[model samples]
Target chain A: MKGLLIKDFRLMKSQINFFIILTAVTVVLAVFSDNPSFVPGYLPFVMSVFALSTISYDEFNNSSAFLFTLPVSRTGYALEKYCLSLILGAGSWLFALAVTTVSGMIKGTAVFSETAAAALIILPFLFISVAVMLPVQLKFGGEKGRIILMIIFGAVFLIFVTALKTGEAIGNDIQAISNPLSGVNLKALFAGAFIAGAASLLISMKISCSVMNKKEF
Target chain B: MIKTENLQKRYGNFNLNCSFEVKKGCITGLVGQNGAGKTTVFKALLGLIYPDGGKAEIFGKNITDFTPEDKEKIGAALSDSGFSEYLTVKDIIPILKALYKSFDEKFFIRQGEKLGLPLNKKIKEFSTGMKAKLKILVAVSHKASLLILDEPTAGLDVVARDELLEILREYMEEDENRAILISSHISGDLESLCDDIYMIHNGKIVLHEDTDVILSDYAIIKVTEEQFKSLDKQYILRVKKEPFGYVCLTDQKAFYAENYPEAVIENGSADKVITMIIRGQEA
Candidate 1:
């Protein structure tokens, strides 16, 4: 597993310039945006997408077939991808939040607790997104998997757009719908989602293992 | 050290059902043309492909039960698909170290330099021969007890091919218990190195012979129509008709030489033996 991680990280070196550019754009957006909450999720979400691209790297030139012949097992290979995703996702999530909080403090525009809460809320979605993308990339491969990624990316975008609303009515429309169910508690709903996210992430890892084991090459 | 019992795989029209073994202290060669199922056999043994119906064992254990340590002892280099082309040799050393406890960094680096493989260049920029050399070097660096290599000498010039074969020979020499099962389209490579060879054609093991026997005992007999009519057919394995008469492949070279002193006979080679087995009709 360590070897596989090293290989993935080394592969990532080929696109370091692109990632650096992405980090710069993310920093600029977080520092300049009025609603800093949206900036935190934005960077982490984009970083998670980059994490998934490692699978495409492995699939290119049919390298996966030789990769599996190494000492690593299929289950170990699947688990390593999740580990990589978590490391990248959590690391960027913290970086984005740090910039948001520091910028907010300099301008006297933010409370740390409120900002932290909003950012924490995105962690589960980040995991769920990873949970969904890993198996799709494993099963469908890079070529067809790109289409699925776009669809899933679109869905995640909609979720973020609805959560922020941006003076538009996407979230307000949801608020209006939930008005009738006001008796439902928001805290319990969030707790339920957190558990579901963790569970689905595990199940997705298992599915990726099966996909790898059944693969011919 | 490796054995398979009727390992079977079917890909639409091609069906692979082969039984072969590579004993300790031997370099076993699997020789065949493209689409002849050599790669299928290698993949099955390596657990890269699940055999539809059959069993295989390595190091006296079933392939299904191979623990990580067991796999660590077996190094494989396939003709297709290796370390991603995006990576450089410098990047592979640390990864190999992390993966194999026995990986020798000094040896790998030394071989990389010795082979003229640039350490810092991404593999995508490597020429075909360079890539082939890298693949074999990676396999042999870990001190594996067994090696499964497919087309290891495919794209090398004669000198590079000889250098690559010497590396393989040195690897086997280090541990007398070591064994290798390799395949190549270039029969000269195998004929010069292998102790024995298996001829696989149309997804089957058509012939198995010691390299020495194939060279010394086996002979091609070219006879005119009148001569072939009276020739004994029991020793012939395969026969092809020619414009003048027939070309017969026989293992008993001495019998034909003594009985038909006037008949035309030529020494057998790996290429001629494979061509006869694959293209000639059964005698």
Candidate 2:
């Protein structure tokens, strides 16, 4: 598993410059706009997508076949991908948080509250994105997998737009929706989201393992 | 050290059923043309693909049941598969070190340098010969008990091929328990290196024989039509008609030489043997 991780890290190194430039640009935009939430909100998604790039690299030149020849199991390989995703996602999230907090401190702005809120919302989405995309990538590989992902996300976007339009047509009674959640415990809501995210990841890992096991080459 | 019994796999029109063994302390060669099912056999043994029937075993354990520890004993260099092109030789060393308990980092690096593999260059940047050499170096560096090399000498020049074979020979000399199951289109390499050789045709093992027996005993006799008609046919395994005469493949070289003193006899080379076996008519 360590070997697999090391190989992925090296493969990902080529994109390091791009990531650094993107991070700097995001941080600069956040500082200038006085919207520190933007950094934490977007960084996790970028990192999660980069994590998937490693999979593409593995599939390139049929390297995955050779990879299995090493002392690694199909289950272990699936688990390692999940672990690497989480590590990269969490690392990017924390880096964004630190940058936002420090820049806010220097500028004398109250950024922690906004950053924390954004983290809570985006972190779960990051986990879910990785959880969902992994099995698709493992099953279809890079080219076809990307096409499937695009179609799925396109459908999701259409559905979200439709829901928003319906809410507007219904006269946008925001208070009525908030009323039912007014007494809900924030801690419990966050815990539930975390549990759901963890469950999604575990299920994804199982599916990836099965896909890998059945995969030829 | 490795064995396959009635191993089978089928795709639409092609069916692969091959069985062969590589004993401890010996180098076994699989010789075949493209699409002859040599890769299928290798993949089955490595558990890269599930066999539809029969079993493949390494060190007496079924391939499907191999744990990480069990797999650690194997080092393979597959022709159509390899490390990501983005990785450099330096980047791969640590990964190999962590994966194989007995991986020798120093030796790997030294061998890489010796083979002219640039340490910092990505694998994609290397030429085909360099890539081939690198793969062999990686496979041999870990001191594996079994080495499965497919077309390891494909792109190498004669000098490089000889050097690589020497390295393999030295590796085997280090441990009598070690074994190698290799395949190459270069019959000369197999003829010199393998203790035993298996020839596959279409999707079946057509021939398997000891290298010594093949080189020492096998012969091809060129005889006139009259001579061929009068010659005893019991010793002939395969026969091919040519414009000049009849070409006969026989293992009883001495019998033909003594009985038909006027017949032209040539020692069987691997290439000649394969051609005759694959294309000749059964005697």
Candidate 3:
């Protein structure tokens, strides 16, 4: 498992420069913009997707076949991917939090409170995104996997646009439908999201392991 | 060290049903043409692909029941499978060290340098020969009891191939308990390296013989049409028509030498033996 992790980190070495540049640009934008939510929101999404890139690298030359010949099991391989995803996602989130907090302090802006609250909301979303994407990438591999991801995101975007247009057409009636949710307890919502994310991750891991075991390579 | 019992896999038109063994202290060779199921056999033994209706075992344990400790005894270099091309030799050293308990980092680097493989360059940047050499080097650098090499000399030049074979010889010499199973299309390499060889044609084992028996006892009898008509057919294993005469493959070289003094005879090498077996009419 350590060897597998080292291999993945080495694979990610080529993307280090790109990650650094992107993080810098996002931090700068967040610092200059009034809405600090951009850094927290974008960091989770980007970092979670970074895990899929490692899978792409592994599939590039059919390296997975060779990997199985090593002292690694299919179950272990699936678990390692999940662990690596958690490491990258949490690391990115913490880095974004630190940068936002420090920059807000230096600029004498009261953005830390808002950033922390936004992080709580973004954390579960990151978990769900990675939990769903990992298995898809493992199942379809590089080219087809990316194509599937694009289609999924495109459908989501279409749905979001249609919902916004429908709400605009409905005007005050849309607020009335959302009014009931305003009274929902914040702690309960967070707890529910956390539980759902955890469940999804576990189920995703199980599915990925089964998929790996069935793969012929 | 390795055994397969009626191992079977079907891929539409191609079906593999092979059974063979590689005992400790010797090298076994698998020789075949393209799409002849050599790689499939290797994958089955390594547990990279599950066999549909057979059993493969290494060191007396079924492949599916093998633990990481069991895998640590194997060093494999499979064709069409490798590390990510983006990884450098330097990057691979640490990973290998972490994976194999008996990995010799110093020896691996030394061997890589001796083979002219660049340490810092990505695998994709290397030439085909260099890549082949690197894969074999990694397989041999660890303290493994069994080495499974699929076409390890495919891209190597003659001198490099000789060098790699010499290294394999030394590896075997170092431990009596060690065994090697290598596959190649180049019959001469296997002829020189293997103690026993198995010939596969269209996913079936057509012939298996000791190297010594193949080189010394196997013979191709060249005879004219008239001569072939009178020649005894009992000794003929396979026969093919040639432009000038008939080429008959026979295992009874002594019988022909004693009885048919006028008949021309040539010692059978692996290539000739495989050709006669796969392409010739069975007796």
Candidate 4:
């Protein structure tokens, strides 16, 4: 597992310029934009995408053939990708959060508790994003994997929009559904989301392992 | 320390069923033309792909049960696959260090430099000879008890091939129990390095013989159609029709030399043995 992680980090180092540019853009957005989502939500999702890129690199040049022959099991290879996704996602989130907090304080618009809440909320989003992306990429790799993920995202957006339209036609209260009761336990809600995200991640890892184990090369 | 019993894999019309072994302290060669299932056999042994049926054991454990620790004892260099080209030699050092518990970093670097492989250059920038040498170097430096090399000398010049062969020679010299199972189309490389040879064709092993016996005892006897009809045929293994009557392949060179003084018999090389077995009809 350590070796696979090292190889991925080494592969990522080849894209160092891209890493620098993305961080620069995120920092600029965090300092200039008023949106709290700019820090934790945007950066981590992008970092999770970086984790998926490592999979493409492994597939390139048929490198997976040599990689599998090393002292690494297929299940371990799958597990390492998930661990890497979490590491990259969580690391970038913490960095973005710190930058956002400092910039907000300097701009005299700082609310520590609110900023903390937004950053904390994005953790679940990061986990869920990883849970969805890892298995998709592992199941269908390289160009095929990317195309499939795009279709998945498109289908999901269409389904969500259709559900909203159908609800309006049925005369359901959109505002009530969109904004839950003010009396609802806010802490409990985020906690429940976090738990759900964690559960999904475990299930996704299992599926990814099976996909890798079943892979020919 | 590697054995397979009727290993099988199927790809549509092509079917691979082969049995072979590599004993400790020996260099075993697998020779076959393209699409003859040599790569499939290597991939099966390395666990890069699963076999449809049969049993394979390495170091006395079933290949299906092999763990990461067991894999560490093996070093493999495939013909068409390797580390990603995006990585430099320097980038892979740490990765290799982490991958193999017995990896010798100092030895690897020293050998790389000796072979003129640049530390900063990505593998994509490497010459064919450089890439080939690096693969053998990596396989040998990890102290693996078994090395599975598929076409390690495939694209190299003669000199580069020799250098890579010397590396394998040194690898075998360093450990008494280490074994290497290598596949290459270049018969000279195997002729000089392998203790035994297995020639595969049409998804089966057609011939397996000790290198010494093949080189020293195997022979090709050219006989006229009249001589072939009247001559003793007990020793002929395969026969090919030729413009000059027929060519008979036999391992009993001396027997033919003594029995037919008028016939033309040439000493066997790896190339002749493989060609006759593949192209000639079984006698």
Q: Number of the top candidate by lDDT?
A: 4
Q: Which candidate, 2 or 3, has the higher TM-score?
A: 2
Q: Which number leads on DockQ?
A: 2
lDDT of 4 at A46: 89
Model 3: what TM-score? 0.96
Question: What is the C-alpha lDDT profile of model 3 across A55-174, one tens digit per residue?
Answer: 888888888888888898888888889888988888888888877877778787856777688777888888888888888888999779889988987998899889878878878466
Give candidate 1 misplaced runs (Cα > 4 Å): A152-173, A178-190
- Provide the TM-score for each candidate, comma-separated: 0.94, 0.97, 0.96, 0.98
Candidate models: Cα lDDT each: 0.89, 0.88, 0.88, 0.91
lDDT of 4 by residue, B1-283 (tens): 9999999999998899999999999999999888899999999998989999999999999999999999989989999989998999998899889999899999999999999999999999999999988888888888999999999999888999989999999999999999999998767779999999999988899999999999989999999999999878888999999998999999999999998999999999888988999999988
Structural RMSD, model 3? 1.7
**Would candidate 3 be rated incorrect, acceptable, medium or high by CAPRI criteria?**
high
**What lDDT tens digits, residue by residue, belong to model 1 across residues A98-125?**
9889888887899888888898889889
Q: Model 4: which residue pairs collide?
A: none
User: All models, DockQ values?
Assistant: 0.80, 0.91, 0.84, 0.87
Docking quality level of the chain pair in candidate 1: high
Question: Per-residue lDDT of A1-217 in model 2, one digit per residue for the tens?
Answer: 9999999898888988998898888789667865667788788788878778899999999999998888999889988988888898899888888888788878888557766776777777788899999999889998899999999899999998887778778987657667777789977878888888888998889899999899999
Clashing pairs in model 1, backbone N/Cα/C closer than 3 A = none
Where in model 2 is the C-alpha error above 4 Å? Answer: A111-114, A171-175
Q: Is candidate 3 or 4 superior in TM-score?
A: 4
